[model samples]
Target: MTESDAATASLRPTDAIVLTGLRVRAHHGVFDFERENGQDFVVDVTAHLDLSPSAVSDDLSRTVHYGELAVEVADAVRRDPVDLIETVAERVAAVVLAHEPVHSVEVTVHKPDAPIEVPFDDVAVRILRGRS
Candidate 1:
């Protein structure tokens, strides 16, 4: 494997907390009409961290609370609208990483109802972030 690949693999956490198909209505788009009307945006997030502490102690404090995380992510998306899903993805990642236990995060912002001329299933932006 390449040096970079090895480094990435080594840094990856073994356990994860995944939340998917979170739909939120937000005004985020370049077009004025889209911002005025608003649309549903789907977000998926995976937070990687060591789950062993919570597993062994059965203490909620030992791990990130996914329910709270979901709310934060939704709230982040609903905040001031930006034209790009990339920005939304970054916001979500920041929220996830804010939880001290999270070692890394994967965020996907899906714009299924994006204003597109041609028929398409969906448009999404996915990003990965970790502590440096």
Candidate 2:
């Protein structure tokens, strides 16, 4: 799909599997000190898919396995460090979309301990991705 199409695509109006507040330690930042010290990155993911088959048949295969997804997301975050949380969020979205059952995925990567001189609650990057 074109970039515009992907950007405009709406998430499927179906049951969603949501995982939140997943914390991982990684060295990702634009500054040397920030990357060297490392920091906790919080992730939130939402996968949209049909749950009727899984709900009716009680089959784990019919739906996304969140347990496995979380582990995979953690591993993705721990991969080679990048300078931006946008990249991190994209990595997570890629991992979630890799699951066949997931029609669309929403990923939010939160950098709570960001090296901002100003006092702020938090800094995060959120993205939505879907199959073409």
Candidate 3:
């Protein structure tokens, strides 16, 4: 199947997972100053899976454990300080895909206090990852 077809097939209504507003402090940026002085980072994640097992078993182990996923993202960001938010977003996506039963993942990383010279609420990077 084509990539688009695979992506469309993964978006099953019954299989929905979301991890929102995950706050972490990480040093990530192009500038040296930004790297030295870490800043708050926010991440939002969505995972798609087959929820039938979880429904039948009524067990948390049958589905994705979002709390563990959140910790993994935080650990990755803290351990691997990159030079750009794009890299951070990609790394987070990779970590999520490494988990079992995750057919597709979407990650959004937000930098609330960016070093931009202009005024803005926040800067963010969003990426979608799926099984190939």
Best by lDDT: 1
Give the alpha carbon lDDT tens digit for every residue of 1-132 in model 3.
Answer: 997777677654347689899999988888888899999999998887887898899999988887888899888778768888888888888888887888888889999988889999888999887776
| RMSD (CA, Å), each prediction | 2.0, 2.4, 1.8
* lDDT tens readout by residue for model 1, 1-132: 997886697458689999999999999999998899999999999899999999999999999999999999999999999988999999889989999998899899999999999999999999888876
Please, what is the whole-model Cα lDDT of each candidate in the order they appear? Answer: 0.92, 0.90, 0.84
TM-score of each: 0.92, 0.91, 0.89
In model 3, the worst 10-residue window by lDDT is 7-16
Candidate 2, residues 24-48, lDDT tens digits: the string is 9999999998789899999999898
Candidates ranked by lDDT: 1, 2, 3
Which candidate, 1 or 2, has the higher TM-score? 1
Pitting candidate 2 against candidate 3, the one with the higher lDDT is 2
Runs in model 2 lying further than 4 Å from the true structure: 1-10
Of models 1 and 3, which has the larger lDDT? 1
Instruction: Show the colliding residue pairs in model 2.
Output: none
Ordering by TM-score: 1, 2, 3
